[model samples]
Target chain A: MRDASEPGALPTPGGPRVRLLDADSAPLLVRDHFAGGDPGPIVASLAQVPELVGPTLPFLGAVLGPSWIPLREKEIVILRTSAVMGCRYCTDTHTVVALDSGLGRDEVRALRGDLPVAGAFSDAYERALISWCDAVAFGIESDIRPARAALDADDARVVELTLLVATTVMLNRYATALGLPVSVDARARLAEEAL
Target chain B: MTALATALADESLGGRVWFYTNYHCNLTCSYCLTESGPKVARRELDRATVLDLAREAKDLGFSQIGITGGEPFLVTDLPELLAELAGVLPVLVLTNGTLFQRALLDRIAPLGDADVSLQISLDHPDPVANDVMRGPENFRKVVEAVPALLALGIAVRIATTLEDGDADDLPRLCILHRSLGVGDEDHVVRPILRRGRAETGDMGVRARYLDLPPELTITADGAFWSPFAPTVRGGSLDTDLLLSRTVRPLQRPVDAMITVLSGRPEGADSTLNIR
Candidate 1:
């Protein structure tokens, strides 16, 4: 069986519930979207339903793309959200992105819940962000107070961070439920970084 | 050039401008996408609008123009409209093939010399089986029209809209279309989509925006996502696929579609892999 990191291999124990479409057979609009290179497994899987690509991608970009939150903080929320949700595809894929965005290996591992956050996150805001993500991901209403208090009182920052975490959580479920595979490039980068 | 023009120039994306010429047809096909029949309201795109859009489409980098309707031939001056539109870009008109009596065929015979082709619908090899979905005498009319249209030196293509159980008839349909002077290359076979009149039936495939490609289709109502977008169900138009209400400036809807396409994060590559 192909490993999780193989180009077309699904990370799930079995495989993807839906077939991924390659550039050759994908619709013209889809091909237009991934013109620079072959689409990642997440996109290819969604290509099975081409119409979803238009609405889904733009919404995904708005939620996860450049926003009021810093890249490091955004990755923190995303990693913790995926980790708590147990989405291997997103956890592994975003690990590479988090690292490329300047997150330390220990910080990345800690965010993925492989290690405790004692020394990994030195910033109070980051620590609070992680707690908020965990609280949100697990749907624990009471556990959100300490984190919300420690995080700054900037309403915009809190909302942006909350939406980021929420969107990542939704993506984690989608990627996990679909049994999407980690790309070979992302997997190689993860290995190289020893994460 | 604008972002929309640049996107349209990519041949792989299939930048075809479509016009919904009219919305009334002679027959009430069971699976008509627009629910076009003799009794349906005639929401037509006039000749001037088509010619104007064609000119704008050519300037905007669209490669071809497609004209569809409940039936395009029902438009009194479709041949002249087609000639004007074809002068701007290659043209394809979708028709039921049932309207080509001697006089109408003679009128459209001039299209043979223009950069235009007609795609006529023929669902089955057996006339009875085909007419069951398309209406009575459909198969005979298409069979007769293909030879007559071809004799006028016009290009003809046969489109087969198949139901789930109709796969067995394809080989026979191919042979039938070939015998009528249409080559195998000119035969189009696709699943009848569950839209408009076919929505209540289990005979066609389910269609959704996510599953369908974005083609800039302009109707009398507005610009649509695809020719399949401006559908009529229960005597009301389905707005699920309407792109923009203002299509006159042409840039309005083209930009709307471009805005939607630009949301893809993977970005675009340069290659005309699809035609």
Candidate 2:
């Protein structure tokens, strides 16, 4: 039985169900994308959507790839959404991605769902963005309108951020269901970055 | 070296290419990932770009194609686009399954052979839950479209996303699918992605990252790493995850995501939902 940290491992007792796609036989594109690396269970389970993969792939790209939202703004919403949704893979991955994007160590902590009081967040827009995402993440529909207002609806970035939040939230459930495991190296890297 | 590096070095392409047929949908489902609905802005790759991606996928040895969007059928020239795409690779269109009425189906009926299929969404067996899951009257159209589409020689499959309390509804939903002529095997049950309206309004929907699916996407925007990303919001070049501006070659960000996604197989469980 592979441990919980290992991809393709058996599900721990009482965990959400999981299924794997055969790595050797996955479509050539998927195999190549993982660089013939461990194709993880998430990749395996996508066999569940073979027919829909083509259609659904681009939405992921549009939201995760590039859009009207700026990188910093996008990350803030994503990190906040990840926290609300309890998606570990997103929180960890975005932390590294945020650090790579030049966020300070403390700011990264703020993104991990910590209190903003540690001087972790410096940008006013980011602060407002966090509040809005927090509202959105917890399913406070009415609160979202005000949060959206505070973030500035007139600015195009806010609109894009709304989309980003929506997209990440969807992915949060899918990723959580698929069980994206984190790497030991990634853990070490994120720890170092936070330091 | 990580698996992502190894995967990138192989230089293969087009196993399964996802094209955003368009970025608008007829319905505004609360949990939509793209925020697609009638009122949303329309963003679609032009005909030339679709053809360009098809050429790239064909040359790269892509196996098949998946066409997705607000509603793939909403593209003004869906039939023409499907014909062109199916000409290059086998194509499947993921839809709410509400668009194909008698007239629209007649226009594109020729491509219904092995080249195409439809994966339609239905939430619960009851019209009320499903209607609420989708929007106003979504359930009836999609449910009714299934047998009609199957009659057109088009393969039909049921795709459902179950929330926390929604699993008990699955067996019944599968039964409902059978009543509509779809078998249990033809029904695919999945978890709701905490997106769009779902994220803001769904307290029951759970979320965590899945290992990056080894899939590539193309559109007017650019080549992307994976659809299951946190999304870079900008004009295009400003984002780190844009794998390429054109289909020519992938940039480095693809490698970055794959490395993280390929890590820790043992951690692949829904319990990773960190509080």
- All models: lDDT? 0.80, 0.63
Note the clash tally of each candidate.
9, 36
TM-score of each: 0.57, 0.51
Residue-wise C-alpha lDDT for candidate 2, range A79-132, written one tens digit per residue: 778877888767776777777777767777777757562377766667777888
Which one is best on TM-score? 1
Specify the poorest-scoring 10-residue window by lDDT in model 1 chain A.
A1-10
* Tens digits of lDDT, candidate 1, A1-195: 112234545356777765555644454346665576566776876655555677888898988988766888888889889998999999998898898889999999999898998788888767877888898788776877766877775888888778888888888888888888777677688888777
DockQ values per model: 0.02, 0.02
RMSD of each: 12.0, 19.2
Quote the TM-score that chain A achieves in each candidate: 0.90, 0.78
Model 1, residue A36: displacement in angstroms? 32
